[model samples]
Target: MRNAEVARQLGVPPGTVSYWLHLDRSRRGECPGRRPPPPCPRCDDTPLDEAAYAYLLGLYLGDGHIIQHSRHRVPSLMITCSEKWPGLIDEAERAMRAVFPQNRTCRVRKTGALNVKVYSKHLWCLFPQHGEGRKHERHIALEPWQQAIVDRYPWGFIRGLIHSDGCRTTNWTTRIVAGERKRYEYPRYFFTNKSDDIRRLLTDTLDKVGVEWRVTRRGNDPYNVSVARREAVALMDRFIGPKL
Candidate 1:
């Protein structure tokens, strides 16, 4: 099948299918316009034949899952905190393949970090049946309060409730942009939520910034909403109108 057709059927981009095919072709020693058979059955320590590998690779390319074994097939050689090694990745892949012939198809990739200095010396096998690349989700914009939480924590913060109510009307307003521009209906709403002790930290920080906020129930009931909460909702309606 053509790359685009295969990608459309598999729900991925055509470039991804082409990349995988290129990787497969590279592994078969057919990169410079040479046609070679599929990779060997035991090429990467997988207990499957060439046909099985082809079928499994197809399934993997088509969004199939790769099962991981509970135990490591070959024990990893642990190297201590020795600073003598520079090209550890190349050295490790060579040593591993010498010890286990099937590891020839495996590629050594780097990951993880140390205290101040980064550490990288992990080896992973690239089986044709299980080498599909990863997918990444796009970053999304966060609400004002969520942005506040992210700014304070740099990791993440939780929100129990967010109340936003606003009204829309057809009106023209002029504003100075690069020159001058007109805008339609504007949005006027407020956001508030309950959190644990961590929220108390956020609340104290937000108070200094004139955010007009308060905390009802703290750590007692994380998800529980009390009668006082309804009063807060009513207050929001009074301050920020009745349409949301």
Candidate 2:
């Protein structure tokens, strides 16, 4: 890593880290009676906005993952989004940057999807969702502070969930009434996930957001949350808007 990257990871000024790096071991002296410096800065030391953290956490739970290993490769946090929706990938990068400022981040180019990844040991501590198998095979719960953040910014958290595992689309249909056929088109927001707890968490937040959502089915999973009513769609659009 470069001086600026080290400074960012250490939460120190670039010049300070530079000064230390420029000095040779023979010339660099330590103060007496002072303890040795830490092996590395804590990942939690990276500053975080509660809402942003919660949103990233939601995305992590929905479609992101962490890889842990003792050798072969560095552990990393990775989130992949469809190539069709580059905006979501951009948002995920921003969110990851904000939360894991000290980690070395990268983007992987693929044929059908965009992947954002960061390497850090402290990331697992920040989010304990790492477990065996898929999320549905395990339980997803929130810490007290995370719950508080979600309570304050339910829409932001919901946005992350929707962007990761959900989608926005237009629905067109025709109905015949009184021998008259009426054609109409409407926009709807839908989220599908296999984790019952995640679906429940999303619905509970929607309840708090005052946006009514209905449970629906999709081929991916039987658990789904959808917003199709005119008013509900309007409300969801207020927060999530369109996926660019």
Candidate 3:
């Protein structure tokens, strides 16, 4: 059967059939270029937007994934964004396009969120942290080069993480002011991730940016990093405010 026919009948992407055929051909020593790889900063020395990359990196580590089929040459980078935050979805797509200006991006709806994805052969090159298993199951650490970018754009990086796995909330209490009872509101930031390494990365960046944070134990896992200090919350507000 023709590959396109098979793909159409099976409701699979045409590229999937092509990838399987290509793999069979390679076993017989026939090698052909399926698709030319897109330009990559690490491979082709293409200029990268350091700030955008820093932000995207944070998103990837928090709620993004690079999916590469074992038999396919092209891989897709997917960032899951909640439906409640339409602005965040747009920002995620924009950051991806900024990082790979020549590539096209798309959104796939799933459950209550959208998967903003872009396909390229160079995703692994750009995100070396891509590997088997969930991010929390593995040791997630940035390369020295990536760390430099984040250091240069700490706010962008923090914003990305906040957009994905963190949130800004208002905490309120009653206070007496001038002999009158008044409601006082405190704005705080919280970043929750199961991976200790990922949490450390956030805290480390927060420290670099002079944003004070403390680890708050939520349930059995101490997965919450809270920024409640007046100065720290103000800093977060300036750099990485509520998810709009």
Candidate 4:
């Protein structure tokens, strides 16, 4: 049937029906004019930057999402970065490009954040955690292969998480020293996520790296992982620093 007919019957836009038909033909190798998709690291054994992949994975768990619309030919990997930190947007784009060098990436401004996205059919293969419903509502676990990559580049993963949903802030208090009031400040790191599994990933990696962290409650929900120990904060400062 024609796309218009299908669109009318299904109550969808004609363009959507056309896109679906085009995607079906392309998948069957019937669309000779379509550009062939680039090789995938998971399926084609292509070389991948494990460190970058680890970092991208962290950002994904924290603030990233993949869209696979039935009417779209390819899925999009999107990581929402705050416009307040333009540098993070660039870094997120770099990470996406590094993970999929052959694909092009684009940024769409939305309210106060920029959605950094790249289109590729292999996004699901790279990010196996993509699924139905919100990430926090679903069971999230890393496959063995992804775990191996994170294990090798734990700091990179932590940095990615920090850049996405974590922050470095200073806490200050007043103290009496030699009959004079003195102000003292200490810096700490906080990683906040709604998903329990995502928070566990951060703390687990922190443990492997010998960085002490404690779970903190936001109101009634324990949704924050705090790294406030002097030694741990120093360690995090040395590696992750503040998001630019």
TM-score of candidate 4 against the unseen true structure: 0.86
Worst 10 residues of 4 by lDDT: 27-36
Superposition error at 105 for model 4 (Å): 0.3
lDDT of 4 at 35: 69
Error of 3 at 32 (Å): 12
lDDT of 4 by residue, 119-180 (tens): 99888899999999998899999999999999999999999999988999998899999999
Candidate 4 or 2, higher TM-score: 4
Instruction: Compute each candidate's TM-score over C-alphas.
Output: 0.18, 0.78, 0.82, 0.86
User: Can you give the lDDT of residue 110 in candidate 4?
Assistant: 97
Q: What is the lDDT of residue 244 in candidate 1?
A: 23
The CA root-mean-square deviation of candidate 3, after full C-alpha superposition on the true structure, stands at: 7.4
Candidate models: Cα lDDT each: 0.34, 0.80, 0.91, 0.92
Q: State candidate 3's TM-score.
A: 0.82
Pairs in clash, predicted candidate 1: 166-243, 166-244
RMSD of each: 23.3, 10.1, 7.4, 5.1
Q: Which model scores highest in TM-score?
A: 4
TM-score of 2: 0.78
Task: For model 4, give the RMSD to the true fold.
Answer: 5.1
Q: How much lDDT does candidate 1 score?
A: 0.34
Across 3-109, the per-residue lDDT of candidate 1 in tens digits comes to: 99999999999999999998988777879975543233235343432322222221122222233345643323322111232343333333334333443234323
Residue-wise lDDT of candidate 3 within 142-196, one digit each (tens)? 9999999998999999999999999999999998899999998888999999999
The candidate scoring highest on lDDT is 4
Over 4 Å off in model 2, which ranges? 1-46, 70-74, 219-221
Tell me the number of clashing residue pairs for each predicted model.
Answer: 2, 0, 0, 0
